[model samples]
Target: MSLTCGRILELTGNSPKVVVACECLAAGGKTWVLLHERHGNPLASIDFFLKDGFHLDEVLGSSEYDFELVALQPGDRLFMKPCQPHFVFGYAHSICLDPAASHLPNINDFDGLMDLLSACVLVILGNVLDFRTYRAPSQDEYEKANKNQQILIDHEINSIPISERFAICYARGVALRLINWIRMCSEIRGPGGFIITDLPSRFFVQIAQTLIKYKEGANASKLDLQANCTLGMLTKQIENVVEVDLKISSLWSKRHLIPSGSLALANQGDYSVQWPDPGRKKWSSIERDFMDAGVTPLDRLCFDTQHDRQHLELSVVIPQLKSRSSASQHPPKRTKS
Candidate 1:
C-alpha cells in the first residue's frame, strides 16, 4: 500500500528505510516495520501488554488508560491492536528520548508488563482456573498475583524506573483477580454426607492450599491477618522446620584466623567464628586465646591439657578444664597429722 505525499511518504526501499510512524492493532494482531539504522547501533527491546485492551471506537470515547512501557527509539515500530478488531501502524522515533514525550501518548510505553504478569502470577493461576471453555479466574489466584503487582505499584509511588513499575502492576493485578474466584468457592461450599469434606463432591474439589497463597499481601499490613487462611500463614506454619540461614559480618577486624587442635595443627584452622549472643564487645585473655575470628563452631577446643568436644557442642555452659583433683572422687594427704 502507498500513501499520498500529504499523508506519509511512499517508499520503494531505495535509501531511507526507517520511517517514523505510529500503528495500532487489537489483541493477537500482527504487523511489520522496516528498521535500518543509517548510523549508530540498535538496542534490544522488551514488550509489556496492557491489563485491558480497548476497541478503537472505545478509546476515542475516553482517554483514561495508558500503555504500560514505552520503547524509546526512533526507527522503532510498536505493533499493537486498535481496540478489538482494527489494527494500525505506529512508528517509534528517537525524539521520544526527550522529556517532551509527555505531549505524545504513544512515546514511552510499557510492553514488557504483559509477560511479567503472565510469568509471575498468571502461570500459577491459569492452569488451576482452567475450565471446559471459559474458566472463571479465581479470587485466590488474583490475590497472589496482586502481591507481585504491589511491588510495581510501590515503584510508581516511589518514582521508580518506568519499566519496573509497569512489570509489577501487571503481576499484582493477576494475583488479585484469582482471589475473587476463591471467595466464590467458599460461599458455595456443600457437605459430603456430613462425614468430613470441604467441597460438595470429592471429584470437584478445589486446590485450596495453593489458592490461599494469593491472599498474602506484599505489605506488612497482612501481618494483622494471623488467623485468616493466607499465604503468609502457611509460610509461618512451617517456618521452624525450614531453617532460616542468616549470615554474619566479622565482629572484630577479622584479620586473624584461629588454629585447629590446640596441641597439633593449631595454625591450620580455616573458616570464621560467629557468636551474636556474646554480651560484651571486649573479650578476656582466655576468651581471646580460644576465640576464632574467622570461623565458629570448630569440632574441638583446647581445655588446658585435653581437647574437649563438649565445649563446642554445649550452648550456655562454658567448658571447665579437667584437673587431677576434679577427676578424683576423694581428697588425700590431709588425714596424716
Candidate 2:
C-alpha cells in the first residue's frame, strides 16, 4: 500500500513529493521544530510556515546567527538548503515536502502514512521532554514506581489471553534504544565545534509530558532501566561539554593579558612568572628567585600533560578565540619592565 498524501505540487520540473504538515498548539511556552539535515542530504525540500508569530534561528558553524521573529499569513514559503541546520520556535503550523520520500516506492495510502509520521514525530518530541526533565529518582521512589508499573503490565498481559507480551516488550525496548540514540546525537558536537542546534531544555520536558499522556492512553510499559541508563550517559556528556566550554570562554576573556608570542605556549600549559617587588626595590632578589625556580621569560611547564579527547576538541575552538583576540582594541598587557 502506497502512502502518498496526493498534496504534491509540481513546480519547474522537480520530482513529485509528499507533504508533511505539523500543527503546534499554544501551551503557554515555546514550541520548536529543529531540522539538522534535509532528508539525509539527498533530497531537496521547501518549507511553508504559517506566520502566526514565530521566531526563527539559523545555526552557523559554532554560533547562532540571524534571529528574526515574523508573522506570516497563510501560504508563505521558505526555501531551505540541504544539510543546513535551522529551527523555528513558538506557536505555529508548518507544511513541508519530504525529501526522503523520493527514495520510497509509490505511496498510495497518504492518510495512513501521515498518521504514522505524525505519531513518530510526537513520540520523538515526547522523548525530548523526558530527557529534558530527567532527574535521578530516589531509590525508594524508583522501586515503587517500577513495581506499580510492573503490576499494571502483568494485569494487561493476563487480560489479553493471546500471548503478545513478548512482541510488545521488544517493541518497547527498541523504542527505548531509539530514544537513547537520539539523545546521544543531539549532544554530539558537529564539525563546526557546536551542537547541531540549541534546544531549550524545557522543550524536551514538554515533549516527555506529552509522550506520557500517549503512553497512558496506549497502556504501554516504560523501560525504566533503559531510560535511566540513557539519562546517565546524557548527563555525563553534558557535564563534560559544559566544563570545556567554560574553560574556553575564560581563556578567551583573559586573552588581552596574554602576549602574542606566549599564546602558543599558554595553550600547552599554564606558565607563571614572579613579578619584581616594586615596594622593596628587590630586583636582585627577584632575579635570584627566578633562577632558583628555573623560570625563564618564555619558560612553560605542562603540569598536567595527559591529553584527552576534550582537549583535542578545544583545538577547533581555539581559532575562534584567536579571531576574537585579533579584533579586540585593547593592547596586550605589559609583562616586562
Candidate 3:
C-alpha cells in the first residue's frame, strides 16, 4: 500500500508477520507498536479500546501503556510478533508488502504446536465473548450465549476443508482447549459466572505429599474435595494421611503455582500462603482456596519443603573442610614426618 506524507494507519492486531518496504522511504517513515506481552492474561478484545473513545496517539504516548516507535527505510523489514497492536505512518509515498506468515519458535519437538493452539484458543475466546461487549448475564442468557458459542464453533469447524488433515487436527485441539477455558470462566453462584452456570462443586485432585523439589520420587495420593474448601482445610486432610507437619507454605498446581509477587521469595522458601496479600487475614483468611485459584477436577498439587521446619538441612560448613589457604598457612608440620 502507498501512503501520502503524514498518512497514518489505524491500529490492527493479527497473526505474526513481516512487513517489507518495496521502495526507499521518502523522509519520515515510522510504525508505532504496542505488544500484549503478558502471558498470564488473555488478549484484550479490540472492542475494549474502540468502545472507550480513546485517541491512538494520546494513549500510545501515555506512560501507562508501553509501546515502541520504529523507523523504517528502503529494504528495511519490520517484524511484528503475534497479536501485537500497531499503526504505521509514511512521510513519503512508499510501497510495502505484508504477507502474514507463521514463525516457528525454538521448541524442536512439537515445533511450536502449543503456541499455535494458544493462538487458536484466543481467537475462539474472542468469538465466545462476542468481542467482550457483554458481561455477567442471567441464567437464560448464559445458556443462550453458550449455545451461540457452540454454533459458532460448529460453523468454523465445518468451514475447514476435510482434505486438510493438519487443519482438522488443529481445529479439534482448539475445541478441547476452548472447553477447558470456558469451564474455568464459569462461576455460577453469583455474578462470577461469565458465561456458563451451575457447575458441579465436587471434584478430585492428586496431592503429592513430598516437596515440589523432590516430585520425581514423591508418592501422590488422590483426594475428593469441594469447591468451597479452603487451603487450610485441605492441608489438614493431607496431614492426617501423610503423618507429617505441613506448613501453609508454597503449594503448586499443574501449570501455575507461584503468584507474581511471590516469585522472588520462592527460591528462599518464603512462599505466600495467601492470595492478594500474604499477611492479611481478611477475604476468607490469608490462604487461597481452590475456587479462588480456579483449581478444577484432576488438577495436581505439590508442596515445597523449604517452609517445613522438620526437614533436615544438609549443608557442610566450608571452613570445617580442608582448604588451600589453611594448608598454605599451617604447612601440616611435615618436619615431624
Candidate 4:
C-alpha cells in the first residue's frame, strides 16, 4: 500500500487492475503508470522494451506508441483493462492500493470483442515469457533462505537483480496458475462466456521465434510452414508426426472447470483438487491456406479422424436441438388468469 521513494512495481500485465491513490507525503509525490491500450502500442514495441533491459524512457519516447503514462495524485483512481501491459513507479513516498481481476466491458460489437481477446493473447505470451525467464529455487534452498538470512541458501535466487524479484515470484508460481485459470474461464460459448482471451497463429509464430532467441525450448513437433501454404500442405507436414487427420483449433480452444463442491469440502487447509480433461471444440475452421486459416507452428493442431469429428459435431448439435425443442414445448409464464 505504501511505497518508499524511488520504488517501482516493475513491468507486468495485470488486466483490470485498479490503483487508488490514498496519500502522498513528498512535494512531488506521484505514481507513474505505463499502460498498453487497445489498438495503441504494438506488442513488438513492448517486446523490444523487455529485451532491452526495461528502460522506461527509451520505450516511451522512441516511437509513436499508444502507451499511456498516467501520473496519479492523492485521491486519484486509475482502472486498466485486461492484459494491458503496465507498470507503476513511486516518484516519492506514497500510498496506493492496487486490486486487479478480470472485469470485461459489455461486448456489443466485433471490435470490442477483438480488443478483449487480443489483450488475452498478450496476457498468455507475457506469462509464457515469465515462465521461461524465472527459475524457481529448490525446496531445500527455499526452506533455508529468508530475506534476512545471513547465510543465504537460495543463492541462485538471491543473485537475481532487485528489479526482477517480483517477476521471478510471478513466473515461478503465479504465471502457470493464472494461465490455467484464464484458460478455464475463457470458453467460446455464447454471452455467458468468461473473459475470452485467445492467441492468434501469426503472433504465436512471432513469439515462438522470440522465445528461441530468449533460450527457451519448444518441445512440440516441428513443421516448417509459410504464409502461403495450404491447409492440405500443413496437414501433410503434420502427418509426419500424427497418424490421423488433424483438426486445427486456436491455442485457446480447450475449456476446463473445477468440479462442483470441490472447494467447499476442503479441510485442514488442504485446497488441492484434480482437474478433468479439457473439453475440445466440436467444430473447426474450413479455411484453405495457413494465412487464411491462421495456423502457426506453435498452434496445437489436435488430431481426430474425419468421421470422429463429424460424429462429435452431430453429438453436440443433436443435444442442443433437443434442449431447444424441449424448451419450446413448455408454456410461457402466464399472468394471473
Candidate 5:
C-alpha cells in the first residue's frame, strides 16, 4: 500500500495523527518513519526531555534506538507500517517504537522477549525517567505551524525514585514529556498541529550519537559506576534484529528449501521466490533458547532441524551382563564351529 499520499494527508488533517506507512524516499522494503524534535544545531539532535533532565537508562520498556548517519542519506525515505505498536513512556519527549514485525519476520523469533528485556532494564536503571522530549529547530515548514508542539510538556514532576531527593530529577519529568509527545504525534495536524513532520525514522541516529556520549562519559565518571547502558543498548538491538518464533515451527516453512534454492541460483538470473506461512505453533522459552544457542550462525543461514522438529533419537547402552562382543542375537562374523 502506498501510504505516502494518504498518510501525508492523515498527518495534515485536523488532529494530526501519527502516520504508519512506507517511506516514500527509502528503498521499497527497508525503511521506517520516526517523529522527533529537531534541536537548534544543524547537526545537533537533542530532545527537550534530555535538556529538561530525563535520564534514559533503559527502564520500563525504555531502550535507546540508534542509527548511524552514514546509513541515512538526503531524501532517503522511511517506510512506515501502521500495525506496529508505539508506546509512550512517562516523559513527554521520549517515545519507543516497539518491534515492527521484528524487522525480520522471516528469521528471528523474539516474541514476548522484548517485554522481559524492558522489565530487566527498568529494574537495573532505577532512576530512569518516564517522559519523552524533542528540542530541535523545525526541519520542515509544516512543523512551523505547530511550533507550540512544545506546550504539551507540563512542569508537574512525579515523586519518583527517592535516593538523593535533591539530585536533579530528569527521568520522570522528561518521560512525562515523551508520553505527551506521542499523544501529539497521534493528534497534531491541519490548522493547528504537527504540520508536516511525520514520524522521523532517523530518530535512532540521534539516539545513537547520545549513547556514544553516554558510554564515553561513563568511562570518565569518578565513581566508577557500573553503567548498564551498553548492555541495554545491545538487548534493544537484538530485539530489533531477532523475530519471535511466531509460528508453531515454521518461518514460512518449506521455508526449509526456499532460501537455499535462492542462493543456488546466484549463477542464474536475479533470485525470486515467495515465503509462505506454515501453520500456528507454540514453543516454550527453553525451546527457543536451545535453538538459538545451538545454531552457530554461518555466512549462509543454516538450521539445526532437531530444534524445531521431533525425530527418531538413537542411543545404545550395554548392560553389565551382556558379553563384551555382544551382537543382536546373531553369531560373530567368519566364526567356524
Candidate 6:
C-alpha cells in the first residue's frame, strides 16, 4: 500500500527481516490500502487501543486473504504476522503497526526516545496554551457566528504574537507524539505483563516543571488562564505517573528480591503479572530523590506573584509586626521617664 504520514521500516523477527509501516489514527479514522507495494511485502500488522477504550475493525479485500470481520476493544490487541492486505478502521485513538521498507535505529535508542519525549511535551503544552486558535472551530460553530463576530474573533486570534503562536503549536505537537510513544511502548509488551521502568519518572519531571514555569509566567488574560489550568492538569497527570512508578519500583525492589513462591504469596498474586499500588505515604523518600535530581516542587514551580506576596507578608512582615508589638508592651522601659 502507498504510505502517507507514516513511517516505513524493516524489522527482523524469528523469520527473515521484513518491512513495516506504521501510522496513528484518531477516533473515527480509516485508512485505504493496496494488497501489494513496491517497498516490501507486508509482514505483520498490529493495533493497540489505549485506556480500555475504542473498537477496531478490519476487512480484507482479496479472496486469497479472506478473514471474518473482527472487533478489538480497549486493552484488546490484535496481531497478524505475514499479514495480508486489509482496510483498517479505528474507533478511538490508536496506533497501527504495519510492514515498511526502512529501519528506524532511533526507536530503541535512549537519546532518540528522550528527543521524542521532549517533542511530545512541547506539542501538548503548545496546544493547551493556544488551543482556541491552534485548533479550528467546528463547522456548526463557525456557521452560527455572525460575520462581525467571526471577523473580530479572527482578528483577536491573529493579534497573538507570531512567536507565541509558533511556540504553542510546537508544544502541542510534541505532547501528542509523546503520548503516541507511550501507547506504542505499552503495545510492544503484549498482554498480561507490566512494562516496569523508571524512564517516565526520570523524564516527566522536567516536562512538569517546564509547564509550571510557563503557567507562572502567563498573564491573567482569558487565554492564559485557560492555558494555566490545562497545564496544571497535565502536570498533575505527569506527577501521578511519576508517583506510581516510584511506588512500583520500591515494591519491586523490596518484594521481588525474595523467593518466587514467597513473593507470590506476599503479593497475593504473581509479582510480574501485576503492579503493586503502594500508599501515598510511601512516596516521601522518592519525592526527596526527585528533588535531589533538581525537580522543583509543583507549588514552587507554578509560583504566583500574589501568593508569594501573601507568603512574604506573613513570614517577614507579620513577624516584624509581632516583635514591635511585644517591645511596645514593655513600655519601652523607663527610659523616657
Could you give candidate 5's per-residue lDDT for residues 59-120 as a string of tens digits?
22232342212122324433332323223222122122322343322211121222222232
TM-score, model 2 to reference: 0.21
Give all TM-scores, in the order shown. 0.15, 0.21, 0.26, 0.30, 0.19, 0.23
Instruction: Report the C-alpha lDDT of model 4 over 144-164, residue by residue, as the tens digit.
Output: 234543222112222333345
- Model 2, span 1-337: residue lDDT tens: 1121213222234643333222222122222343443223211112111112212434455332233333333343333322233454434443333444432322123222223333433433221223322322222323323564434322221222222322332333343333332333323233344442222122223333333333332233332333422433343322322222223224434444433311011121121112123522422221222122221111111111113333866888898898888868677787997
lDDT of each residue in 92-205, candidate 3, tens digit only: 556554333323332222213233334433332221213111211221322323565444322232122223323333343344343343234322222332321211111011
**Whole-model Cα lDDT per candidate?**
0.25, 0.30, 0.31, 0.35, 0.27, 0.37
Clashes of each: 62, 12, 0, 2, 70, 24
Order of models, best TM-score first: 4, 3, 6, 2, 5, 1
After TM-score superposition, what is the CA distance of residue 331 in candidate 2 from its true location, in Å?
88
- Candidate 3, which ten residues in sequence have the lowest lDDT sum? 198-207
* Shift of residue 224 alpha carbon in model 5, Å: 2.1
Query: lDDT: which candidate is best?
Result: 6
Error of 1 at 119 (Å): 0.8
User: Which tens-of-lDDT digit does each residue in 95-170 have in candidate 6?
Assistant: 4443443334354533334435545444443423333432223323223344654453333322234355444434
Q: Please give the TM-score that candidate 1 achieves against the real structure.
A: 0.15
Candidate 3 at residue 12, lDDT? 35
lDDT of 1 by residue, 138-191 (tens): 223223324544343222121233243233334333443322222222222123
**Can you give the lDDT of residue 177 in candidate 1?**
33
lDDT assessment of candidate 6 = 0.37
TM-score of 5: 0.19
Q: Tell me the lDDT of candidate 3.
A: 0.31
